[model samples]
Target: MALVFVALRVLLGGFFALTGAAKLWPLSAPESEQMKALFVQFAEVFPLKLFGYQPDPMNYQTTVGWLELLAGLLMALGPPILQEISNLFLTLLMMGAIFTLACLKECLSTCIPAIICLGLLRLLDICQSLVQTKKVGRYCRKKSVLKKPWEQRVSSCQL
Candidate 1:
């Protein structure tokens, strides 16, 4: 189980880290415009439509890159608590991205990968929780068993 978890973490974490890092690079005007167009496509279905905020494509990409990089780092660290938090955040981001793209009727090939990553992250979180719950149950059972003899001895003495 631990090995499985580790492998999942490495694969998911490395992918996000690489993708995020790539977005941090400066692009030419044409590239920037292309990216902005993509962002506009994504924002078309976003729930924040009421805000009337049109995000700059380059800025949005950079911000998303940073988020992915941070989430990837946290997952790689293998801290259950942090992983859960990062997983939830990433899941929501991916869902929103998918929804926006779908709404715009834009077939972005990259969204598939994002969805896959989200699934993997969520799986890892569930696995981590199961492992934690198992450990806690085992500890509690051991403690209860160990206390039974002491309680019996005290009761007999009182009698």
Candidate 2:
């Protein structure tokens, strides 16, 4: 189960990292124009307006791209606690993306990538919780066994 989580983390991390970099492509690059156009189109569905001030579409796109890139890297290489936090950020980003696609009346096929990413994130979360719970339960049971006078007191925790 832990191996599964690592594999999922790498998959999700690599995927988002590549996508985030794509969104932040160089100004003269063709991909840059496409990403900018995408944000403009999505803004029509939900103007990204918070309060009374509206942010520039390109800025919003850049901010999101930066976040995705940072969070993806953290998810891949950070400590366990940081990994969880990064996962939370990524989960929110994916949710927003799916909402955007839905607002645009996109077909199911078009939304599949975001949906799949969201699912994998969810599965990773569940697996993490289960692993933690299992460890705690196992520790308690082992502690009880080790309390006997005849048995050696040994502690082993291997992930």
Q: Top model by lDDT, which number?
A: 2
List model 1 lDDT by residue over 33-131, tens digit each: 776677666655556766887666567778888988888788777477787787787777778777776776666685687678768877887888888
Q: List the residue pairs that clash in candidate 2.
A: none
Question: How would you encode candidate 2's per-residue C-alpha lDDT over 12-118 as one tens digit per residue?
Answer: 88888877887787556676777788888777665355555565788878888898888898888888898899889999988988998998989999899999999
Model 2: lowest-lDDT 10 consecutive positions = 150-159
- Which parts of model 2 are misplaced by more than 4 Å? 26-28, 47-53, 142-159
Pairs clashing within candidate 1: none
Cα-based lDDT for every prediction: 0.75, 0.82
Model 1 spans > 4 angstroms off: 26-33, 51-54, 107-111, 143-159
Candidate 1's C-alpha lDDT?
Answer: 0.75
The deviation in Å at residue 74 for candidate 2 is 0.8
